[model samples]
Target: MALTVDKLINDDRFCGDNVFQFVAFLPFALLLLVARVFLALFLWIASIILPNKSAVRQMLSTLACWTFGVYVKTKGTRDPRCSVMVANYVSCLDSLAASHVLGTISLRKWKVPPFFASTLGIRNAAQFVRKQHFADCPNKPVLLQPEGGPTNGKGLLKFTDWPFQIGNRVQPVAITVERLFTNVTVHRQSDARDKFPWSDALWFLCTPVTVFQLRLLPPLERLDDDDNVFAARLRQTLAEALEVEMTEFKWEELNRGSTATRREPPAELVRLARQVKEVLPRVPMRDIMRDLSVTRSVDVTITNFLEGVTPFTPEPSDAPTPSTSQAQPRYVTPVPTGVFPKSAKERQLSFQEKKAQMIADARKRYIERHGLSLALNNC
Candidate 1:
């Protein structure tokens, strides 16, 4: 429990501290890195020349397993029966464990770790949904982290609906970590720091003995085929199986935490600005610009204007309305011509008279459409 440099060096378990584990696994880790790079290179070239690309991917997957200690568990077989794999994401290593041991393609983000993006491009064994076109892929199995981004393994974020939309049975794969040396879970919202995925991988790979428990749940087949319901059910299933809390925390909230800076204006200002946007939903942009009178396009200065104006903005008459001379012409509705008689006497009928005539005409039309006998019966 006492983690120190001295303890790491002297500890016999060696897995007690990350520093010790890093020292122990440094050589093997380096070798594994080089090996994976070369394997990725081989797969890239082989994919072009080799007639059996699956075989090459198999070899790459095997190499990946050797690089990291990946262990798989399932109810029946290690391989999943479905085409799409949905999992509760913990770290980027989930991609590796699933790809190597399960021999499935991981769907990743637009940006991944440099090591992953550079070697084998992750494209070799995994796929990026945004970057690649995998909708019509002939391959049976593809992996997806419905949570969108990694969590602390204590909470499950909202699941994406894409997996259910795939038109195939979803295999809910739960990847949980049993830490031996260091916490393999990436800290929540640490992605704002440059190259976060790489840092997570370092913690995972340098650990002396980290076992990844990959469990492939029963394939889900929905009758109603509702994306939201299916996604929610699958998320709940994974959460319960993995023993993590299902949360409403979304990607926006996560990124918001990461990018939140001290330079933000007062919370009161932000809340007031939001209220202004809500109430004056259709407020013209030019009016806002005129009120702010901001010469520069910087965000903070504009926010400051909004904060000041929203709370104390006066009524329309009190406010400076846009120039009427410069405003567009108002639209006028044309008067109905023939709903009444053409004679001036009839045309000049009172409002009550007009209403009575319109009602009579409507009743007449309804009676004619329904027939006199049916209309009388209804009455």
Candidate 2:
């Protein structure tokens, strides 16, 4: 299969391409969602009371996983000596599941509540001096999802180079999240713009069960000075392990295309801009479109142009006249013919004055063409 942004990102909420099953399970999913909310709250409180790494805390972590219907099955032993652990990011819960199995601390850059972070074994990057500080903590491997953000399990996004800078030896962990009844394991990229990480947690709670299959590969030592090459090698290893294609896509591309930043102008505004263009043929289409976007009215845009409130370079030549095949006559104001001024003193007309003169001339021509002088006299 050819790789594309759409193929890598999960753009739909329903799995197996079935909407009927989602509708049928809605009521039961809602009930489960409510129950999971309370359970999550309880888990948060328990995490605060119990000490980190205590037997009771470990049990609570296991219980929390069971409560949220998360079953983690791991293969291969994690290296005790490797301080940095790199993983393929699939969902928000990847850290939670990885921490439970490997006893590692996942570095989170985004703002997450203290209770939620504690429950999920996540530490804010702000807590550390630099990411390298994570290696100082004894017996705890520092987990980094170098893909930068989550994607659907179909492909691996290009890995970031910074994660490999923390340590010379890093362990690669391949994670795959699968839902029993549905393919909707995580939120779509479009939904991510508005929704928080907890929103994905809520969806996980609504599902019947989510299975996380983690395969821990042996630690790989950096053979060269380049961190990017090492990061790429690790990315390829994970992609092969997960049986997914490797992609050159980055998380920044995903954010740039989100609904919040990217939007199409309204059809009405475009139509208004075209109308304004007809009247102000000397003004560039972009300038007219810019004014129409804000004013959203042809009359307002035209008035702005007439009053010199909007600044724009007048087109040097008149717009092309319509074809003769059309029945209606087009009145195009002719461009003024003039010789280039030889001296600076001779070309004293300022830009604003020249624009004003052009507008006045166009208005006079329009009035004469439409015989509006007789109509004005009657008014």
Candidate 3:
């Protein structure tokens, strides 16, 4: 399917596109955010105290869903025979909703706190393998998001093959998340590029309500099909179910696009670098420009330079003067009044002094050459 980057990823914010609505809802959103912080803390501590499979933990999970404004509705029954459940990634809470309804352990690739992952039924790849290897396994099935990352719910990303390789029969679960007041479900813009999972969670708290609809499809047996074919078929099945187009776009492409968008213009970078150079005259312009490109803030670049977080070689100052040919007619040149520093550090330290002295010497020369002093005397 031919799909643009905007169709695959959400480029909007939680505050939304309407300036008037954003301003009207700002106070309520802030209040809700502060309350959710405490509620999340309580849920975190409770998850730690209680066992993963305990009834109390389950109740806490339900309470978390209610408190955080997450409502999940399941349409079809999950197959008991399938060990692996592949789903379309839509939001950070996809696993949480699936785990609550289907009792499935979602495979996580990113590093999160142990309790946090446990609370959300997220397991690392190693833990997933260990669980599959061990004789005593939990009754819950393994949930895998083959898309590797979340999208805007408008399209399905190409599925990876490893999830299909895990088991012969895989269940396809289609999850659709909808939020009130804003079109943004997951952040894919350049500004929130680095603040992922946390940013998503914060938006969830800010939003009044988020509804998740999960449709569980029947188990598909691989039979004679290879991993790639099996994965493609499953992806097509999900696309049909979700009523969205299947795109060849991957998470890597999304990351590259966001990075490209984050890059500042050349003029902006130069301006920021000059500001940093003003504060740190000893720091080379090249180093300042490099750091400014990444930080994109004059204050941050200056702080990084002062903290010695940025390592750089001092700019070269001492160079041999060009040799003149003896055969050429040479005119007598006046000796320089200002002293030149041999080292970069010395030059940086005495730059202002040298500048002032040069200006004074130039003024003196102009007076002598043009007879300005004689004119002043006559006046």
Question: Model 3: per-residue lDDT, tens digit, 161-205?
Answer: 573256788899999988766654544444232233777677778
Going through the candidates in the order shown, the clash numbers are 0, 0, 0
User: Which candidate do you rate higher for TM-score, 1 or 3?
Assistant: 3
Give the least accurate 10-residue stretch of model 3, judged by summed lDDT: 370-379
Question: Candidate 2's residue-wise lDDT over 1-379, tens digit each?
Answer: 2354545655446666566777888899999989888987788778778776557756876877866788899999988889888898888888779878887888776576777776677877656554455546577788889777887788888876573355788899989888845553343344442234666677788987899999999888987747777777888889888888888878767554343222535776678777777666677988998876555556667777766778888776543444545453333333443755566765654443455445455555444553442121111
How large is the C-alpha RMSD of every model relative to the true structure? 19.2, 14.1, 17.6
User: Can you give the TM-score per candidate against the true fold?
Assistant: 0.51, 0.63, 0.64
Model 2 CA deviation exceeding 4 Å by range: 17-19, 129-136, 181-195, 258-379
lDDT of each: 0.53, 0.70, 0.70
lDDT of 1 by residue, 260-367 (tens): 322334553445444433333333444444333221222332343344432334323233334535444222222344575777777666454654444344444433
As for candidate 3, its clashing pairs are none
